[model samples]
Target: MEPWEMREWYADYLDACNRHDFDAIRSFVAPGVRRAHLPGGADAWVSDMADLFHAFPDWRWRRIQLVVEDDRLAAHLRGSGTHLGVFRGVAPTRRHANVAQFAMYRVTNGRIAEFSGSADEVELLAQLTGTDR
Candidate 1:
């Protein structure tokens, strides 16, 4: 896809994420995507996202910047949400947290084939737990 197409595609994907539309998400990710260290596939991907959604019902990811090269896309985003449910052993703190994340993705046949990223979850966790990381 061209850079403009990729940008539009990425924006649509983020829209799906912001909407927490798992069905829509399935359309953008490969069946067996390498989202985690291992290939978890779209179902697993949705399940993981469900977990996050459960913990932060109002979670949102806003695009800060995006760059496209070939079939690869890099996104810088600012994510914000409230700790309303348990997350990775951390009980609900009802605290709001904002974090920065950078994700790199590869697209194949117009679907996300694989992706990896780093998020400031440590900082978010600290903010939620009232402790420094």
Candidate 2:
């Protein structure tokens, strides 16, 4: 796929994520996909996202930046959500937090073949718990 096509595919994928559309997510992932190491990885990625959305049903992704090269795309995003349910083993405290994250993706045949992301885990924990990480 062309770089522009890859960009659009990525945008759509993020849109799906923001909407918590698992069906759309399935449409963009290869069957039997694997993530190298992330503690349950791809399955957990999807499930955790769903869990997050359940906790913060209004969470939204604000694109900070995007770069595309060949079949890979890097995206930076800021997400904000209100605490309304359990998250990462913590009960809801009605706190809201904004998190910045970066994701690197490898696309194959217009579908996400591999994805890895990192975020300010310490800050997220601190914001959620009212303590320093």
lDDT tens digits, residue span 12-118, model 2: 98899888898887788765555656643456667767888888888888899999998888999998888889888889979998999988888887677787787
The candidate maximizing lDDT is: 1
Q: Residue 96 in candidate 2 has what lDDT?
A: 91
**In model 1, which regions exceed 4 Å deviation?**
36-39
46: Cα error in model 1, Å: 0.9
User: How much is the lDDT of residue 118 in candidate 1?
Assistant: 84
Model 1: which residue pairs collide?
Answer: none
TM-score of 1: 0.94
lDDT of 1 by residue, 27-58 (tens): 99999788746447888889888988999999
